[model samples]
Target: MTGFEDEIRRRLLSAQDTGRIEGLLFHSTAEPIVGRLHGDGLDVLWTARDPWVSAQYIPNAGSEILLARPDDWRLKDRVAPTKHDVLYALACEMSGKECCDVEWDWDGRAKSWRVPDGWPTYGDVVGHIEDHYGYVANSNGVYYVRESAGVVMPADWQIEGQVFVALDDGLHFKDVRRSGEPDLTEREYYDGYAFEQAMAQGYDGVIINDHCQADDYGNVPHLSFGLNAIGREKVEWLALPAVRRHLDPWYSGEAILTPDLDEWLADFEMEAVHAL
Candidate 1:
């Protein structure tokens, strides 16, 4: 019935069949919450996937709506409830809901229902802005994708024709950015944890993942070094690119694989080569 609720009703409810409506709840919370609703049991949930999402929830009346990880106690934050009927009606009129059956008048009453009964019918308002912060491999270095997207502002790095893709939080890559290309400020890129790990292992830049083997998910193959990871904080300056020490079809495909870093980096070489 309010301005924000009216806007949310126009956006999210129709996205039910689209699988994970991007902005379904949690506008002013610490993190961005997104979710979907089930019409069967009227079950619903919302969450923050950035900054390392975990299964969690908490209970309180801070807001009329509850946001949390599905089937978990780790709640993100309390969000105000929206008029689901308003959004639902808009959704049905615009895009048919194939995900679940919805009833604008589920209670059999004309929006005159009281609390507890009407509470279950309300939806939560999610914001359109999203924050993406993480480490993605660049050739010899990494691209720290630490930026947020909103209606008024454009994202700094994205997956279009741009070099940086909005990969998830826990993903890795071979050096996607090359050295001497341009932009070497820490604010643009963070000093990779992979380089730091190699230094922590007394190898210091000797064990970078320029030509390292990786899984289809962009994760380092058999890699447990826990290096080159990213946090929520933005990179203060661009970091130096990592050293190449392997051979493959990836960016630093001409480097050699080290015995210490790539004991089996050679095994995945055939697969990488076969692709080319």
Candidate 2:
């Protein structure tokens, strides 16, 4: 069960049965695997490209290698695996030690983090330990882990002090703060979030991706993403013909108003078509 050939085959079958086959890369062999790497002539067994990513066992099935068809193993540009992958994180968690240092690229610049001396090894820790400094990317890959003092940024880049979660988000640099002070900070803004800024200031560029949208912050260099709705809770609305203005007492679901209800309103002084 540990490293047996049959066990490996069984595991592969299990993956196929579970319908989790996306990046499957298996080498087929007309002959059957009976023993170790020498017996089967295959040295590698169940290994993952990265810890977080799905585990793709080496192609060793039939005589031909059955890989994920859509998968471009022969493609020119293949993604490289990182050492601080999920396995490293799990190992760190299980061993109670931090693992994997990730690298980052900012504004067409590469950034490296610095680690401290005498750090604990993967063996020293015993269970899942948390590395607070390392940032797990959207791909679940760890990067820029610095045990000494957080991620190492460029000498020219100002330290924002706060930790920013790397997601499909955009940031901006403004020249003023709400307290009417000169703002030299890297501010974050997105679609739904812009509503608050716009309501407060009467203008905003971060949410809409335009000139200074926030009247309070005024016009400034906006470094934001092309995200659709910045800060509002996105809701699914069915677009149907509206009969009148939405008059639902409670905001339960969509209110598709119709313009056919009544075109006349009764007023004490004003005459309507009904009066005529």
Candidate 3:
């Protein structure tokens, strides 16, 4: 047995019970929790809740490990798993199988696994890092309770359709050194589709999530707009360097959408609220 596998066995055996084991898996951000002996390598999966996480990693050949997503995709260049990713990892471990490899057979329902067998285990490495943890909401109406536990909600948060949280992504931030609030320019960083769509739907207010200066991507500063209604918006915006830092972190919240809001928007008031 390799040191990694030996470590996982030691911890699993030391745990008080399966429940504690589950807790360890649920709360960790960069360690492997689930394991399996596979053909190519020893597969290990991680699901941690924290500043950032890999959620899954496999010790590939030559002392290198391949990182994976909770849904079993080989994740690349990402910092952490969202709440959903952590939950998925927990659920997989509970099944006594690797999350990414097996197609779960639960009461005839079709649920996918998040981790598969084929890499080295690193659960021990993640448990040692308590600086950050991921918090995933498990139920409807559970979000309110979770807020107290570090589940952050945006200011212009709109709970929409009892299924998802919607926001205008219009919270513009003035650079602390700036003399005044910046204005929207054609070349500035903004989600034109979100702005135009909000106007078309006649929403009472369009919330701006981020309006700040960024320099990681050369000199052309950019603005970021998040329209949480359509999930596609997030998928696209996650690529922006500024948005990746400021906005993507909040995408980890529970499925919530709030409407009938009266905050952070004035010019767009006296407008109708419609779902596009």
Models 1 onward score TM values of: 0.16, 0.13, 0.16
Q: What shift in Å separates residue 10 of candidate 2 from its native position after superposition?
A: 69
- What is the descending TM-score order? 3, 1, 2
- Clash counts for all predictions: 28, 45, 40
lDDT pick, better of 1 and 2: 2
**Candidate 1 residue-wise lDDT, 1-276, digit = tens:** 344433433333333334342332210122222331111121111122210111012111112211221212312332222354332332232233322322345655343322222222112211211222122334433222222231121223321110010112233323323243333232112334434443355431121112222222232221111112231121111111112222233443232212221222333455559889
User: In model 3, how many backbone clashes occur?
Assistant: 40
Which is superior by TM-score, 2 or 3? 3
The per-model lDDT (C-alpha) reads: 0.25, 0.25, 0.25
Report RMSD (Å) for each prediction in the order shown: 23.9, 29.8, 26.2
lDDT of 3 at 122: 31
lDDT of 2 at 167: 14
> Model 3 compared with the native: what TM-score?
0.16
What does candidate 1 score on TM?
Answer: 0.16
